[model samples]
Target chain A: MAKKKSESSVSTVPSPASSRAAGVAPSHTDLLRQMLLIRRFEERCAEAYALGKIGGFCHLYIGQEAVGVGAISALRADDYVISSYRDHGQALARGIPPRTIMAELFGRVDGCSKGKGGSMHLFDRNINFLGGHGIVGGHIPLATGVGFAIKYRGGDQVCLCFFGEAAVNNGAFHEALNMAALWKLPVIYLIENNRYGMGTALERASAINDIAERACSYDMPNEVVDGQDVLAVRDAVLRATQRARGEHTPTLLEVRTYRFMGHSMSDAASGTYRTKEELEEYMKRDPIIVLRTTMEKNGEWSDTAMTALDEELKAVAQDAWDFADASAEPAVEALTEDVYVW
Target chain B: MPVVTYRDALNQALQEEMQRDDRVFLMGEEVGVYQGAYKVSKGLLQEFGEMRVVDTPITELGFAGVGVGAAMVGLRPIIEFMTWNFALLAMDQVVNSAAKMLYMSGGQFNIPIVFRGPNGAALQLSAQHSQAWESWLAHIPGLKVVAPGTPYDAKGLLKSAVRDDNPVIVLEGEMLYNTKGEVPAEEYLIPIGKAALKREGEHCSIITHGKMILVALQAADQLTKEGIRVDVLDLLSLRPMDVEAITASVRKTNRAVVLEEGWEIGGIGAQVVDYIQRECFDDLDAPIVRVHQVDVPMPYAKNLERAAKPDVPKTIAAVKKVMYLDQ
Candidate 1:
């Protein structure tokens, strides 16, 4: 097989001018703020989990904030979003209220899924956020179906399906991609290659480490982007979404990123499967700091302003925690509700 | 009214529903180009065109999930599995995604999709292909399991299943595809979760559904000649089981025998027995006897396969046992 050129390889550096030329992009400061909010929200979630406030398996999206924030920024309000279990960032990026997400984590009735979905199964139909499906690669087919519906209805809406690198190994991934490609459905299969699927390293799980290369079998257009850079992920995803909406074509995008925390709260962040050196190397390219430095270089933000912004985000996270704490548990009668529709 | 085969009845239901609703479409392996594996979806592709009657790759999980996704967003998808045995590959999507989406999303999504296919034993398909899944699927809370016996019920119930705003599993009998029955010339729909009394009798009630209904009828005819009138109750829908119809039949006859094409343990008969004993214990003249396929994987040998399945003799024996005439 010949080496396939990644569509995103040409644009490694972030250019605000290019982003502006792309038209109506989120300001650099706004993107930074959103990523910061997600970081703080995840940190608060870890603290709450330790305090026995948030039960069930809680997978934090600490390091891969840029991938979620950047990709979701490109999608239209009517478009659908579906992701794997590590979904706090995606939920926040899709504009689900932080309080509702926090309440869902707290298993409250005010939660998005009314305490039924808990952490891994957050859903908001109003914004078209399909779900935070717990099973790996299980939601891929759903995304395909969403695309099929759009085509069947003669709509230009696109579906964005996000999964980890480990999900590529699942049979569902291949099956969904094949169907989407064959049908010429409007969908974007975004792979957040965070280097580790739970404790299993990407090298240990997948035969071909370059996740985008696997898309060749489906004859779908594919790209690899620097997931640590918010602008790069945004550009690639925007292009993919446009292709999906305009041409009714699906794209397989592999965003190279990493997670700073363990797979979930259960796994110790100790360097057992991975080394401290590897973790430190990825941390040096931390997505938030990378974007913040770019803004600083452009003279768009100041040190004092950045500090104030961090404090504001912290306050936002604190308010969400407080709101979730005060929310009521779901009524026992609600246990049977929504199970069936007549 | 016209006489039609079970396969033609199902095809008519699909054609009618597709014509009635543009949102409803047929999708499965060989459904479009090959006219369905058993011709259940025959002439549909040519009628509805490729966009509606989609021919999918041999990927059950993928197509099943796609059907679910489409249903979530306001499309009524009719996903044919070719066979219920092959649906095992896509059970995850069926059970986890399609069935639970409405509840998990807190009533935001109602998957109005029908997963229909031929189920249970057919000739010598044997073991892997011959297993009946009505009991297993009925065990699920969010699903409606429909197994029709006659062509009339097949067409009417399927039309209703397509219209239902929930995940409905229509288990078509493979052996009954060629069987003929009279169907209404005009439009009609048989409501799900309702039973039909094929034959009313005074002595004993033989309750069954799907292909076993035929065996029950034959047995009823044999018992009638011996001066033992038997009530043949056909349970068209398994889930949301028609307990009222069952109790009424048992009450009328004061004796009952449950028959099934599936394994004896944890089968539909077992569930019917539980309902009868609990609700109609006073009306029963004797303990209800269950006739079901033997508790073993269906063997490929002709004689062994015949012995493993529930047949006319077995139904007669069960009815006799309930009537105290088998000793």
Candidate 2:
């Protein structure tokens, strides 16, 4: 089919006054750049996976970039961020260096986890990125505990926990939310409703399709936002974070998004479970394209600027791959190390 | 020195640790207003208030993960599982999350937490509630397992566990809770991975821990009356397995009899036998013997429960058999 006229008009140029009135200064451009960086980074990762440079389970964040980049933009440096296995974007959005994350995926000594945790487990304690836990909903409880620790220490800092939409069915999700609500812990449970958990669609897996409504049982404030829109997610998460920091209230946020690629590199991007039409439909609202169009239409950005930015980000992603390729494998003696502190 | 029951000793250790460190807090079912199911945390809620002394819901996996998360961020959380049997619900958190976080994070995180609760059978509590899990926990590499047999060891080990910068599992003996022993009022900490020799003898050694230590001692007493002097070695720590102490005692006695309240398969006794046979193989004058609970679920009937567990008679029989005595 054909592209709609309205979709083209949405990218029409805007006046300088309108851009200023929208307050699209540091954010709109920055969010676009970050989302582009993640897109390019994940594209290179898929190539690296095919080349056998990166091993283990590699879950890409191709389409859900806006959810991670947007929500993380609202967080402070001192606040904590935890997410599920598809965390390359979240880690990059949380400001973790691309080189370190790439090296981790390469299983090299310079990796953040020193080659111990492969792609599925990326961690940087310095930035308070707890980890990229592999288990479906295992980290929910841990995130609640992080909120508990912050509250116990009398800190206004909030923790943002990201998981797949399917995690709502996990007992840990319910138990952790109940505890967070009962204790009034400062935590925001962000669900990246990416339509499918691996191959199972959300509707087939969840009895209640509206995940945000499930939080009401625990008396938590919640919202469902357009995850493909970076600004929308950023605004919603900012409001929730403010409430968490101000009143020590926990919020459940369900970001309605879709993945462009299959679950992982192992999955064939075919129409076995999902229809080709569904992929094409969601591709129309690609987060990077949407954000770039919005910025370009507002006159805050240009085609030449984005083209130059894309080249720069491609170099950055390439530099990460080069650094990972040149890095040394962990020493044999290091195998037994880090098992225990003592 | 002050004479206190094992339960009071644990309570004192928690109170002292919480008083000493502001980051140390307690959370579990019935640990606050209910004062603990076994009253092990008696009077703590009144002193520390609800924040430090938390009363968690019956969601073991949730709170246990919370304790791990809290520990990750430098809060020393003492997560009490009502019993080791109930801890099965949270094994994912205990074994998978807490035990593997440090290694998985490449030494970035140190889980400075303690999972404490009464372990093993306690007077015919039936199958579900009556199970020992020391061996199961000790199998994990990143965890430190400590079982205190007496009031003095209980207080000392617990204090050390709280201060240790790693995940420690303190398995208290339910049957030994009311048993009293002399505990010093002065600040003391019994180093972990060290065993205490309760009674020294020349004929054979009775190596045990937890409630079985008392049974071993009683068996030693009975063996003394029958002219068989058996050494009683109490292995307070299971994971680190006080190999030096076990080897030294086995070398001296030239024979060993291991005792445990868990099943025969993969019990602490099995570990001891492996260690003794490997290290003290040539030093042994006779084959090492193991006395453990019968290989079956603990029955509710009083007589069957007594027959199912490792008692003084079983210990005495093992010691006598290792000494080459008939009957």
Indicate which candidate wins on DockQ: 1
Each prediction's DockQ? 0.77, 0.74
The digit string of per-residue lDDT tens for model 1 on A32-83 reads 9889989988999999999999998999999999999999888777788998
Cα-based TM-score, every candidate:
0.95, 0.95
Question: What is candidate 1's CAPRI-style docking category based on DockQ?
Answer: medium
Report the number of clashing residue pairs per model.
0, 0
**Model 2: per-residue lDDT, tens digit, B1-327?**
789999999999999999999999999999999999989999999999999999999999999999998988889999999999999988889988898888888889889999999999998799999999988999999999999989999999999999998899999978889999999989899999999999999999999998888988888888889989888999999978899999999989999999998998878888899999899999998888889889999999999999999999888888878888855
Q: What residue pairs clash in candidate 2, if any at all?
A: none
- Give candidate 1's total backbone clashes: 0
Worst lDDT 10-window in candidate 2 chain A: A1-10
**Model 2 docking tier (incorrect/acceptable/medium/high):** medium
